[model samples]
Target chain A: MTEKPLLLLSNDDGFDSKGLKELIETLRPMADLIVVAPSGPRSGSSGAITSQVPLRCSLVSEEPGVTVYKCSGTPVDCVKLALNSFVPRMPDMVIGGINHGDNSSVNVHYSGTMGVVIEGCLKGIPSVGFSLCNHAPDADFSATLPYVRRIVANVLAEGLPVGVCLNVNFPDVPDLKGVKVCRQTDGVWASEFAERKHPHGDVYYWMTGVYVNNEPDAPDTDHWALDHGYVAITPTQIDMTAYGQLKRINDWNWNL
Target chain B: MTEKPLLLLSNDDGFDSKGLKELIETLRPMADLIVVAPSGPRSGSSGAITSQVPLRCSLVSEEPGVTVYKCSGTPVDCVKLALNSFVPRMPDMVIGGINHGDNSSVNVHYSGTMGVVIEGCLKGIPSVGFSLCNHAPDADFSATLPYVRRIVANVLAEGLPVGVCLNVNFPDVPDLKGVKVCRQTDGVWASEFAERKHPHGDVYYWMTGVYVNNEPDAPDTDHWALDHGYVAITPTQIDMTAYGQLKRINDWNWNL
Candidate 1:
């Protein structure tokens, strides 16, 4: 008999959120699972690590094919802790999210969900992050199950390339319109702060923004795919090097 | 005069750190500067933003050529706030760091210093992040001054390509060799946790690890440049798409 493939799981919305619960339910039967997730919400944490303080992790539950731990750190911290101390062996896959909100386009750079997958990818693991377009804690995730299962199965069958991971987003509609392999849309968040006066007569700001798509007509972009009701799968990479600009920068007159 | 070329600056090491002070002193004569940085240290805060709570920003001082503000948020948040409400006019360039520590190789993925420049690049501005290999609170930054002046002047004169920013690292030496345009070295942090037993008998962990360079002999990488006492300048981009693997993933049997 063959041992089941081990899957390591985490999320930005904490371990008890509906998104992670649904993910655990969906993948538990297919693999021996170990989940190390933040004890509280850590949205928009990007790749933050808690080096200022020691981390506390406790086993939340352990059943036949699954074990879960809650960590007092960011999503990336959970991944590091799990790989360094928690997992019984190297996981076959490192999966993040079923995040409560979409992580498409420029949002990828600011996502704690993506942080988990990026950390895993950096450690040479095949990784993927999943997100729903809806931000509500009780948002329906039934529409994402089949696609998630299929994607997981395919990745398990054919491992991802080195330094590459997947960022998958599902539209909010209950019924899906298939999947589209897409690129990150060129976009920026505009009008990102709402000003308010504090009770002490000081001005404060809250972050709230509308995304401005630079290429709204591009059908190959993740934003367009989500808008068209398709599940978007963007293959994200860890190498941030701008190879195209390297030569241009090399020609600069460095008078030092 | 071309309005002295407005420059916006920020750093991850808090607004009052020696690194940021030196940066301000170096560039004060070259440009009209606005500095908005974190109120306290936010190391390893990679692109993280504050959405959970309202942010408070207070102006610290305003001189003839420089103005400084302290913000209760991450490095990325400071950039957003400055761009949206603080800057008197659109900045000619955005600069981050003169960081107390190096943000080379995989460190860029977790450096809040890099987060500042990445935010600027996404907003379609010429941006650059500068770092010194030394992490000391009072590290000697004299060696980096000339390079900073030249690089900033270069970027100001010739704007960066859309979606590209620079991550420049200076070695800790007093006398530096000439600058080297390099790629991010392939690397990962290994043995990342130091476990400890709590007084209450619970196991906890602290983050501390050694970076394992996957390609140490590669002379064209930032790691190599730093090791040889050269200023390494790496062009970084906001686009995370694995363009090389998109076709490969498209060929996958994503039968959903």
Candidate 2:
């Protein structure tokens, strides 16, 4: 009989988040688990690596088949530390989050959860990022377990293509309408910062934004699926190349 | 007489880098400029947005058609602050970097330079990120001026497509072979952390890596263009969706 697959887990909401705990409870028995996650919440850390300062990691817990470590870095840093140094061997799969907030639409580019998944994909490993639409610290992930298990199993059974990973976002509903493979909705964050005056008379700004979905009615988009109460599974790639514009750019006479 | 174009500028290497200085020197006389950049070096920050902490900005310099503010945030945050609060109006163009190092191939995904550009594109604005292959604190950018001027002129004359921007990397060589619009090359950083022991016995790791280009001979790739002494201009997009894998994923029987 084959041994259980080794799985690496990480999240952006820190190692102590309810989402990470839920993921561990759901997947721990199914796979040999090694978790290396940020010591604190690192939301909006998109594929950031900590190069300015040295990173420190401490082993917090260890079991027969599960080991967890907290690292002083971003989500991508956790994945890098695991893959490059901590893991005994390259894991069969890398899973990030069951994140506290949705990583759909333009959030995919700003998500630390997706950052971990992207790092995994770059290393030629099958990777998946799971996020819930709810942003509360106490958000319940009970509704997402079955879908998560099924998707994780499917990914393990069918490894992803090169340079691609799955970004699965579950709606914050008690009853799910099932899973839909969808495309990223065209969207942008109408970002604004709220300014406040400090006691010292200095002004500080808190980053805030509202996501505006441009294709709200598009059935094939992840945004639509979530709005319709379904789990949205979007296959994401690391290549940012605009293949459609390449020909036109080539036609530009740079020589002149 | 046409009004002078309003330009927004930023960089990952702090407000004091020579690259940023050169950019100001090159573009200042031609356009109205609003510069919002990190107050300190923020390399490897990628597209990170500072959300947990309140950001502070101090006006460093203000002159007719040229104003500069230093922000305590990531590169993306600088652009966000500029667009959302600092700038009186959305600028005609956003320019990032003249970075201290190359942001070619897979580096684009982890670049603070490209982070600013990506943010601009998401906001439906024309954007460009310029990088030099040299990583010195005082790298000679003289060789890059002609190419930079030409590319910036073209971008100003002809705005980029919707949801698209430019990732332009210059070879460090003094001699030039002109420019090539190419695709991002397939590459991964073989990262390793150098472990060290503190004087008090705590362990820390410094992040380091070597980029390995898998397709070194592909003439169509940005890496090849850079290697052959050409300034590589890759038209980058904000979309991370893997359209090629969509149909196959949709066919997956998730119902089971």
Candidate 3:
């Protein structure tokens, strides 16, 4: 009999998120799971590490094949601590999210879910992050189960290359066509802050933004796939180098 | 007069950091500067945003050519807030750091300085982030001033490509050769967490790690340039896509 695969799981949302619960339910049968996630939501912490304070990780639950810990750090910190101290051996695969919202396009750069996935890839582990297009805390994740299971099984069977991970986003619609391997779309958030007066007359602002896609018509982009009600699997990497422009920069005369 | 070109300044270090002050003193004469930085140190806040709370930005000081504000947010937040609300018009260029520590190679992924620079570039403004090899809060930034001046002047004169920005690092050594446009080195932190006992007998851990460079012999990388006492300028971009692997991933049979 084969030993069950050890899977490291985490999410950007707090330990108690509905998304985490659903993910645990979905992956627990196929793997020996260990979950280490933030104590609370750390939504926009993209690959951020906690250097300012010491971290406290407390074991919150332990079952037959599952154990969970709540970490007082960012999503990346959870993975770091798990790999460095918690797990006895290298995990077969590392998975993050089943996140409460979409992490496609420019959202990939601002996602704590992708942060953990990136950290896993940087550590030479096969990793993937799963996010649904829905943003509600109680959003239905029933439609994502089959796709997530298939992807997870595939990644475990076929380990990803070094320095690469997958950013998988499922459309919110019920009638899903299929999965499409795509590239990250060129996009950014056009941010706007809403000003409000405090009780003592001091002013504060809340950040609000719209995701603007620069290449809305690109057929091979993750944004395009999701917009058309298909699951998007974008292979993400740790190398942020723009190799295409390297020659252009090297030719510049830096005589000053 | 060229109306003293507008320059936006920010740092990962707190508003009162010596590096921020030095940056102000160095760039003041050449530009109309507006400073929006965190109220306290926010190191390692790589592209983090404040979605959980409202941000409070208060004016700290004002002068003829300079205005400073302290923000209750991370470095990325400071830049986003400045772009969306504070600046009457988009600044000609955005510059981050004169950082107290190095942001070369893999450090770029974890840098709040680079976070602000990336945000600026995403907004289509020419941007540059400068860091020294020194990590001391009181590290002498005297050697970096000339290089910073030259780089900033060049960036202002020759605007960067639409999605690209600069990540420049200077060595701590005084005897510098020249500047080299380089690629990001392949490197990562081999983290070691120190276990500690709290006063109440609870166990906690502190994250500490040593950066390990995988390719020390690669002379074309930022690590090589900095090790050889030359200023390394790596033109970075907002796109995290691994285009080379796109075709390979697309060939994967998602037969499930």
Candidate 4:
């Protein structure tokens, strides 16, 4: 029989987040689990890596075929360190989040949780990022378990193509409408900065914004699926090359 | 004969980096500049936004047709603020960097310099990021000036397609090898954590590593061009959609 798949888990949320614990519990029995989460929260960290600074990791727990480390770095750093040093072998799959907030549409790029899985896909490992739309720390994952298992098992069963990964987001409802493969929605965060005065009489502006989705009617999109009742699964790739514009760009011909 | 193009400028190397100063000096004569950059360095801060905490900004300098602001955030944040509130109208182009370090190959994904330009492109603005392969704070910009001016003028003379941006990197040398339009070279940063003992006897791991590019022989790659002493110009896009894998992924039929 083939050995169980080694699963590496991580998130932008600190190690104490309930979502992390639940995800660990759910994944522990199924595969060889190794977690490298932040010592403190690192939400919206995106793909930041500590270049000029050194990153520190501390071991908090270990058991048979399972270990946990609290890292002092971004989600991308966590995954890089795990792949380069911590793991005995490159992981069969890398999973991130079961996060507290929505990372469905444009949020994926700004999410440290999703960034690592994206990094994993870049390194040719099968990867998936799971996020619950609700932002409550104690958000329930009871409804998310079956979907996670189904997707992870499917990925394990059917390996992903090179340089591709999955961005899976779940609706907040306890009753799900099952999973739907969708594309990223043309959505963005609209900014509304608030001006405030500090005690020292310094004027400061706070960057505040509300999630304003531009494609509400596009049912084939991740945003539409999650806004409805479905668990949204969007296949994401790392290649940023704009193949369509290559010809026009090539015409620039710097040699001119 | 028309009004000078309104050009938005930013960099990850803070406002003081000589590369940024050179870029500002080079373009100041030809454009109406709106400079917004981080208060301090934010090099590897890719796609990251200031969502959790509020952001603040201060006027750095102002001399008719030119306004520079220093913000307490990453490059992406600066662009977001400018697009949302700080600008009077949409700028003709958004240009980031003359960055002190290289942001070639896979490093583009972890670069705050390129992140701002990507954000600008997503906002439907023509944008480009300029980086010199030299990491020295005082890297010579003479080699970079002609390329930057040429690319910016070209991009301005003919706007980029929606969602298209450029990642331009120059080799740090006095000699010239011309420029090559290329695609992103597949590479990964192999992170090596430096384990250190704190004065209090606590174990800490610092993130450190050099990027070892494996796609050395691939002639059609950015890494190859940079190695051959040619400047690499890669047109980047915001869509992370792996259109090639869409059908195969949908075949999973999550509807089951």
What DockQ does each listed candidate score? 0.85, 0.78, 0.72, 0.63
In angstroms, the error of model 2 at A233 is 0.7
- Residues B198-244, candidate 3, lDDT per residue (tens digit)? 99999998988988999999998999999999999998988777776
Q: Return the top candidate by TM-score.
A: 1
Candidate with best lDDT: 1
Worst lDDT run of 10 residues, candidate 2 chain B, spans: B247-256
lDDT of 2 by residue, B46-127 (tens): 9999989999999999999889999999999999999988888879999998899999999998899999999999989899
Ranking by lDDT: 1, 2, 3, 4
* TM-score-better candidate, 2 vs 4: 2
- Model 1 residue A56 CA deviation (Å) reads 0.5
Native-contact fraction for each model? Answer: 0.83, 0.82, 0.70, 0.67
Predicted candidate 1 versus true structure: per-residue lDDT over B90-127, tens digit per residue: 99899999899989999999999999999999999999
**Candidate 2 lDDT, tens digit per residue, A74-159?**
99999999988899988999999989999999998889999999999998999999999999999999999988888888888878
- Chain B TM-score for each model? 0.98, 0.97, 0.97, 0.96
- CAPRI quality level assigned to candidate 2 from its DockQ score: medium
Per-residue error (Å), model 4, residue B92 = 1.4
- Candidate 2 regions exceeding 4 Å error are none
Q: Which ten residues in a row have the lowest lDDT in candidate 4 chain B?
A: B247-256
Residue B189, model 3: lDDT of 84
What lDDT does candidate 1 reach at residue B53?
97
Q: All candidates' TM-scores?
A: 0.99, 0.98, 0.98, 0.95
The digit string of per-residue lDDT tens for model 1 on A147-236 reads: 999999989999999999999999999889888999999999999999999788989999999999999999999999999999999999
Q: Judge candidate 1 at residue B188 and give its lDDT.
A: 97
